[model samples]
Target chain A: MHIIIVGCGRVGAQLAQILSSEGHNVVIVDKNQESFKRLGADFNGITITGVGFDPDILKRAGIERADALAAVTNGDNSNIMVSQIAKRIYNVPRVLTRIYDPLRADIYKKFGLNTIGTTTLVAHIFRSALLKESAKHEFTIGNDIGLVEYRVEEEETAAKESGGGKK
Target chain B: MYVLIVGGGKVGYSLARRLADEGFDASLVEKEERMAKRIAEDLEQVLVIAGDGCDPGRLEDAGIARAQVVAAVTGDDEDNLIICQLARDTFGVPRVIARVNNPSNEITFKKLGIDTVSSTTIISKLIEEEATIGDIFTLLALKRGKLSIVELIIGPKAPAADKMIKELRLPADSILATIVRESHIIFAKGETVLKPGDSIIALATTDSEMALREALLGKE
Candidate 1:
């Protein structure tokens, strides 16, 4: 599949490498030519130095035939704008964007764009690993619905033993 | 298979409802009579019983011995722990999952041989971190924040495409762990050439998500 990645930052670069290694056509767009230097001498994909949201830049990145688009730039607005263009104008089958603010996640979701919040995902990791004794408040299964996993600990015992069962 | 969930709170109700929707044999035991009645009214197939989840008698009454997996998701951490222990030790349920409200209590639960989830703490932290850090995929956290698993999908315009995995001078702190293509998962190797549509899973420090992404997808 042909994939276009806007933003040459950490997420975009890594995503490009992953897809490239998997044997798919990949193109990366960025504003700075120096950013491509980070990919090193052996890197093997097309790198376009231009604003990701610019239509001309996208066309140069082969957005017309792209199957998917990922907007993971540092700025949320830029990511959203690029993703919208990719989905609406370019007609990419799949479009994903990195949303820094969790509050805006719902707004993006309503537009049918897949959003991933870096902070929320990370915090969940830390909390799960660090806080294991407190009463679990919520658990989710799959992306939509599946088996939600949770941990049972001491506070739960006190609630059951002292709180008394169903009065 | 009869799935017994101990707790009638949001998690329990949601689980019961979802399982029921999937055509599973699900039941809930809520110690509070009112909560039990409410859950019973809300669910069509779930059998809601008001009883102490930790009590062996209550579990037996809920047919714990015949349950495929006993989930303890009561609001209280202690109650969940006891229910899980009893389910494993006394009732002999094959699978038991407990909810941990406090993130700090995870180790104790693990030592007790029960799976635990600090969903609230973790989810809140996730939201907080996303608000602060701005970029990078957290992937899966491990060792209480000491490690993480992140993924970055190669983009069409990236510089690393068409090059062998060994050719790219990846940072020392990061390692390309797996390559996903067309839903097929492959281990990363030196001879492997990165292509478009490939998803790369890597293990690195929390701060490295952005760097990894830049390395794999950033443009010139």
Candidate 2:
């Protein structure tokens, strides 16, 4: 499997190294040349320095033939843009995006995007560990399915914030 | 209407100035302290807020709840999108406009129900318009085939050059409407002479288009 990663942060670099070591093709993209240092001198995966979401850059990074794409950029918007391009434009079968803001992450999920939020995950885990009953979860679909649900007033907050204007 | 603008870059600064000049309530937010300060040098400080637009605290202080139109024109497409979404989802701003740096993201922005101003699309269109005049240009087309307005330049080697419009055997259905020579508009008439380096705008039918071209260049 060929995987394309859009960031050169720790997670992105480590993921690329691991995936390449596992015998899967890996291509890592970063705008700054310095970020490639994270992948280490022994890394074998391809490293591309350019705007991650640029069509030309993605093409050079093998996005057209990539089996999966992970947008782990620091900015929620950048990650979302990269993910959307990978999904809607290239039709990558597997696309994942990382969002820092939990609210914004939830909103994108409503639009049918696979997203992960670091702050959301950490806070939920912290709460579950500290207080079992204080955990933010709803009933699971079945005993075998562990569905994680957070009690966020997304709909009401959205309607209220629109200040009774056009929904 | 009250307008809240994020990103005090060229677009935001110019738009705020124009809006202020037009007597509308406008405020601008810039994440960079230097940018906000520089913009505040010309505009009122009250109208310029130095803070991250994505932060709800900053948005509330910038009066996002009262913003009728929110335009995020930052350089980063993602930042602009997040700012607009925050304004809409957090404060319920009625109208949210986001600037899209990538043309491919325009469809995604639209699909997510966000109105986007795509700089890539605008730039591409401008380039396309400029290159259209490089060769044969179709100005207008009437119906499906009745008439087509075309513009072409007369080269020095063309046979029609240095000839009077009256002498040229232009088809009955084809008429030379105007001639542009060195930035001057010359109404084409029978006695008007054609010269090299002249842009001719003509109205011709589909069947006569080839004949018009052949007559103008003296070639089939």
Candidate 3:
């Protein structure tokens, strides 16, 4: 798959490495040329130094033929704009973005865009901590559901095996 | 796949519950007998053991050798790290995911070669940001938040269908990730045509999502 990634920060760089390692055609774009240094010399992908929202830069990164686009820059606004263009303008089949603000995630969903907020996941963790006695690990799933992990004791496990029903 | 989670704390218990929900075999080992008993009462399917997570014997008892993944999410960072390493080296678990209480510990975890590290603080900050921002959705954090993959559905009247991918002119910070049509995944490419029913997936920053939606659905 051909993937275009905006932002050369930690998240962007990591994504690029993973995708590139998986044998996908990856192009990474960043405003600062020095950011490419983070990718390292062994990196095997096209690197473009320019603003993420620039038309020419995206073109150079091969957005026209991109199979997927990822906007994970530090700024929320930048990520949203880049994601919009990839989907609306280029008609790229897959578009994903990283949102730091949990509230914006809802708005993004209304517009039919998939979003991830780091804080929401953290909240789940905190909530789990707060309610450690009742539930276990808690993480946000998608919009409606949450993925939570709980532990089973020996007695509970036995009850389950015996069909003892919820205790 | 079976998984072993060390700690009966919130993170550990959460991991157990989630794995069970997904129909995966999971067990928990906690040092506190009371916590273990409580966990036992709460989760019916998970196997709860009262023992030290860092001990090889406890891990073996939890079936770590056969477990696909082991997650150490105790409140203590050092304990989590040690348990994670033991799971990886001594038990030979395929994957180890650890929870970092402090953000600073993340770098050390990375250096130690932990498979995955999640920071509750960072995640909370992001959630707070989302609650306040009002325009983005944070879907999932992968690889310590280095990469995120998200999903979006195209509106029936989206202008995106009218234009070829080469012409839509998307913003720079984002990329069209993939299209799911009737469960089939279509990788984005220049020649790929957008259909009204296509469920799109994308990766981008938080704010640009609106534009991505407009591009696919056309102006709200």
TM-score of each: 0.45, 0.64, 0.40
- List, residue by residue over B1-220, the lDDT tens digit for candidate 1: 7899999889999999999999989989999999899889889799988987766677888888899899999886656765786688666788999998766546546654689878977788889767754434567888767678877777777777888988786767788999999998899999998998788888987666556666777732
Model 3 misplacement above 4 A: A1-167, B17-24, B40-45, B117-122, B125-133, B136-170, B176-220
lDDT string for model 2 (B24-121, tens) is: 89999999999999998898733899998876678889999999999999888777777877788767889999988778667667765789887678
Query: Tens-digit lDDT track for model 3 on B90-197?
Result: 667888888877665565566557755666676786787466534334467565555445566655676777457778877665788778889898899977888877
lDDT of 2 at A101: 79
Cα lDDT tens digits, model 2, A11-54, are 89999999989998999999998999999987999999988877
Error of 1 at A9 (Å): 58
Model 2 off-target regions past 4 Å? A130-167, B37-41, B55-69, B84-220
Q: Name the runs in model 1 displaced over 4 angstroms.
A: A1-167, B125-149, B153-167, B172-174, B177-220
Task: DockQ for candidate 1, please give it.
Answer: 0.01
The candidate that achieves the highest DockQ relative to the unseen native structure: 2
Reported per model, the fraction of native interface contacts reproduced equals 0.00, 0.29, 0.00
For model 3, report DockQ: 0.01
Which candidate would rank higher by lDDT, 1 or 2? 2
Alpha-carbon shift of residue B203 in model 1 (angstroms): 5.5
By DockQ: ranked, best first: 2, 3, 1
User: Residue B159 of model 2: what lDDT?
Assistant: 75
